[model samples]
Target: MLGLDKKDFTLLLIVSALVLLAPLLLNPFPEGSAMAQFNAGYPDLMQRFVIFGIFAIGFNILFGLTGYLSFGHAAFLGAGSYAGMWMLKLLSMNVIPAIIFSTLIAGAISFLIGWISLRRSGIYFSILTLAFAQMAFVLAASVLTPITGGETGLQPALSDPRILPEFLGGGSVTADGNIPKPSLFGIEMTASSEVAVGNWLWTLNWGYYLSGFMMLVAFYIAIRIFRSPFGLMLKAVKSNQQRMSYTGLNTRPYMLACFVISGMYAGLAGGLMAAMDPQVGAERMQWTASGEVVLMTILGGVGTLIGPVLGAGLIKYFENIFSKINKATLEVWFGVFPDWMTDLMVTIVYPFIGKGWHLTLGLMFMAVVIFLPGGLVEGGQKIAKLFSRKKEPETPGGEAKPAE
Candidate 1:
């Protein structure tokens, strides 16, 4: 029954409020605000935030708690996506079965991988996982062409089999029977509807809400794992495996369990991504995608409970927003400055902002690691402490108290 303490409860309340109000807050620029372009309430971007948040949270369970840096996590995610898609193609478009089967399959795959990879520790374990992930990527690209759809990616089509609703009137088959999109109850899970006010437009899609709800559930589970006794054992293993072994605790099973759990989380995220978008690409299993999750987890704060969420949001923001900037937009912003200064600035910054957004992200990540090793959460804590220090002298205990 390990659970949140009072402080943790307060934090959870705050985060819940934020999540609930995110759409409103993100869309409050009056449609013409200078920063309106940066607003994150759009269905696609918001979905990504929650999806990657799940990814980072899952990665945190392994690397943050058990001190195991897995370089092959993307494989589970890709596998889960493919599995979920196959379910959609072969069975009914109900998400429950797809998500469950995807998670279980990913867990099984992780168990096999962990059994082999756990034999090595440190860099060796990392390399083994990397090798495995690369192999998966290659196989998906070639050997698994039928299932994975090869280089063009797996997409929804009319050729899929629909085994549900066998008692249709006269057993008549409809065009919608094949390649059906997943639904909740009877509601379609596809993105639909657009709200436009003056020149501003916002899409209220079912996929966004579905993904958001899933992310909230994922966050709750992560919090539970962080506060659980099992989590403590994993942390102990991370700190000192030899000492844990000396205490008669078998660390291997714990580590393996953690690895499988983490893989399942990644798989869940991948499944949701496919469900929302109805496509699965081989690139999702690439080493670069795995590295992105590692960066998200480390950039936010490795061990802190909420840091991974923050990291996921930040990285995803940059990925979606910054990468969309281009030279034409730069010229528009530079209109405020002198021609020479504007030209100079754009020339210096253009490469890093548009297609080179990754370079900017890399530099910012390095800066965070160098200056705030505890991640953005530590910086926030420091700011809170600074404000609290300023107000403390006004309290009844203004006089210095003796140390215990």
Candidate 2:
């Protein structure tokens, strides 16, 4: 089915179903209701979920399979954003062209960076990549101000000469005094169709679906890579480079290839973000952003094909939840508790939310590292197996019988 073995095909089906149903699942409250604050079914967050999923999935290709931990991958992401923004600024508002440009630019830059960095292994390689990324970050902020829009970042301009879409005003401005929006052949990405049934209102946006579709494609490609002979070589590289050297197989090219591919993935994600929001900030290239993707991959379970996606969604969702929580929101949820209890709960939880959300994320990472280095997926599987074992029938000799 779908050119995949049974297990792979089933996994694909499950992921597809989840992606398609996300809007409904994420939005469980009515639009006008007070609880709507908790609903993340909106287009912006939905787009982020899938976009970051693509980023995580790509990073997984390199770090998970080959164990080449690049601390500078976010530089590629920022580079892609700039490329996408340029395409919009110079070429057209059509997302297709922007996405293509993003992929190509990121891949070229990554190829160069990988060529230089792959010369060293272990911590040395990590440092080289980090240094390159820091240089790019500094350039983007200061010396390259004219090109990168400086600290203010790149935003669609009123003066851009959109050569292709001559009749239409460039992005950030539409012809009829309407705010400009990214589109595909004039179909606006921000456009949405809202269906209200009872108290629930589901918003299906062009941008979210497009991002989700791209994520699906990326995920499929990752599945193929994981099953390929090249993927086996990456695993071998991770397991023992010395053994591979003994086999007379050069691993540098393979490592470079993995780095380039993963960099392209980051670029794709950054381009999508620019297309959706019509802005590209140098902040996207920060080392912290690179660290976040690594955290997402490890939190969800590194080396497992679906782990990165799960981790991205989980982290992003929690980030949103944490950012939105405030004293008022906490009060609403804890209203039933006594005053002292509510106050105590609020005190305990307040530090984890809002500006202190990073503390929460760090604690979660530490817990995952200490308790289950295999990550959440392994922990979940263990719990499931434990439950299954407990549910099994015991035989006459006090041995457990196989579950029927």
Candidate 3:
């Protein structure tokens, strides 16, 4: 109805429903249960899900549409965070200005980087982006100490000249001794209230809802882009760039535009991060951080619109659950079994949890790559197809039952 095709609009509805119901769906285990650890309905983790979903969505725009795989998207994210943090420190504690500043600054940086890197294609392009990211990380950590706060990272302090906020009859000072938290107008993002129904507790945090609202907006933008003629050109670039070039189309601008847009998305995600936590660290620009978003996109379904969001949530949920499983939790899980069986089972599964969550992630990624390279969305499609085949087709007179 809103210029979206039936399937695309349907997909949007499904995503909207899932996101809206996530607080209840994710915390189904209740307050006191053996499976409570698996519940990921908390505010912070939910924020991460939406933020990373935005990151993966942006990444998919470039990688899925234009076939340009970046190994350094985290640089834009870090740049955005730093920019947002500086805005918070210098101007005001309101998150709106900070996020806006982050998106604009990150877009400019990505434009410059894309202009330089688009000269090369394939692995050379990936390597150039990686080199730029590593340089950013190094400079933030060492050479740019005065600006970036070096190893300590950039943080809001009490001594900054917040001219705008002070003139507005408000400041970062709080009634408590601690530094002020990030806010929207006068409403603090970190402020939250809880809803309780019986043993179930749901946290409704302002930051989470704000992030979720941004996610919906981002998703809508992605849908629009995916349906546009520009998206067709990007797909053409991916399918056959030589033909596009021969047709007198300057593919460089299209590729560069995709890169900058994706980078700006990353920056927006990073700004949300700063808005929630008010902290910016150099580790955010690390190569590993960049790789995680790549994994999110591939593991979700690289080309699909909703796949990246699902993938980001899946990865984040697994990371949250697996990292919390310690020896003690394993013992509690195996308490029903005999001593020897329990010990053996715990011994086998122990390495894949806690600090070993990486092992679990690696195994999961391998399985998805090997069996379902199309990712979770493809797997879901296959399952649906199988179920549909099992349903009996109706005869002219009556519904036909499956043969015994």
Candidate 4:
């Protein structure tokens, strides 16, 4: 069976439980507690962590398994977001159809791009994909203004027309002259708040939970793909393309399949983002976003099942949380030191730690590349080995051996 061993399976379950319960644990401190500032229980950020986790996992399947480094993945993700938003505008707010349609659209787009890009391998393929993505970004920004909403971006408005229940007061009456945001069944998905620890705080509302649930589903699907026979075939293509060709196997179709599948995953993540926020912008498909996914996969640990999730969490943490910390906050922390020391420390570390969180991330990436080329997972394994070594038995020859 293509599955984890007992220990690994148990570990996965424990991790899943921990993730699911994170909000409660993180929010346990009272509102006025000093540690409350560090709490990360908000639904929006948690949802993003998982949503991007799915994105990174999908990217890893292509880059990690096939050795194909795509620099245009955000094209598919942005495409999916647009497709899903259109569905919300035209049809019911149910996420099922939105996700399905978005995935299909993303797969179709990826297929076309892959067909052309796969004609060349190595840097040529990367350049082809990059060019296509840049074209997409520009088109979304300009030519498709009517559909894409141009620079201001597309957002949910009550002006949108709904087809069903028009005569029964359930459909497009234009009463308020504003299009209502999409909803699941009858539950509205706008931003909302809740009281936690006697403090009023913003929660994910319905849309965030819906997005989180979809992320979990995406994660499960990715896990299945990682264990599937098709995945094995893709890995084979990655490992020895020449050998596979000599064995009469056509590798192009397999590579294309992998590319499409990965694109669909990116699309799913994009769809969820749109579903939660009901907005689509050209910037989402930019090459920088595509490079972000690459960073996520490499930093987390390519080829390992859970590494993408770790990488996604790490990057998202930096993007959302760390970037929000500014020089003023540093000044507050450094106020405890002598005047000269405070000024010196703030001047020295401010550039990299505050708004320049990306600089720190870059340094981290370089360190990982230099010392732990396999990424964080390899570092974790090395730590585990170090701890386990002490328990190992010494053989008669003075070499370490199994304890038993």
Task: Assess each prediction's global lDDT (C-alpha) against the native.
Answer: 0.81, 0.88, 0.87, 0.78
lDDT of 2 at 187: 78
TM-score of 4: 0.88
Regions more than 4 Å wrong, model 3: 166-172, 175-178, 392-404
Q: How many backbone clashes does candidate 3 have?
A: 0
Please identify which of the two predictions, 1 or 2, would achieve the higher TM-score against the true structure.
Answer: 2
Ranking by lDDT: 2, 3, 1, 4
Backbone clash pairs in model 4 (N, Cα, C under 3 Å; residues 3+ apart or in different chains), count: 5
- The candidate with the higher lDDT, 1 or 4, is 1
Arranged by TM-score with the best first, the candidates are 3, 2, 1, 4
Candidate 2 per-residue C-alpha lDDT over 129-225 given as tens digits, one digit per residue, 9 for 90 to 100: 8899988998999999998998999987767766775434345456685545678878789999998899898999999999999999999999999
* Candidate 3 accuracy as TM-score: 0.93
- Write model 4 residue lDDT over 1-404, tens digit each, in one string: 22755655665676577566656654655676544665666777777887798799889988888888899999999999999887777765655567788889999999999999988888888889999999999999999999889888987666565544543223443456655555666565665557554563435456656665666666666666767888888788778888999999888998998899999999988888887677899999999999999889988888877888889988887887777777777777889999899899889888887678899888888877777777888877766676677665442332222110
**Cα displacement (Å) at residue 172, model 2:** 9.8
Candidates 1 and 3 compared by TM-score, better number: 3
The TM-scores of all predictions, comma-separated, are 0.89, 0.93, 0.93, 0.88
Give lDDT: candidate 3, residue 302: 88
For residues 70-108, could you state the per-residue lDDT of candidate 1 as single tens digits? 999999999989988777667656666677778888888
Best by lDDT: 2
Task: Give candidate 1's error at residue 57 in angstroms.
Answer: 0.4
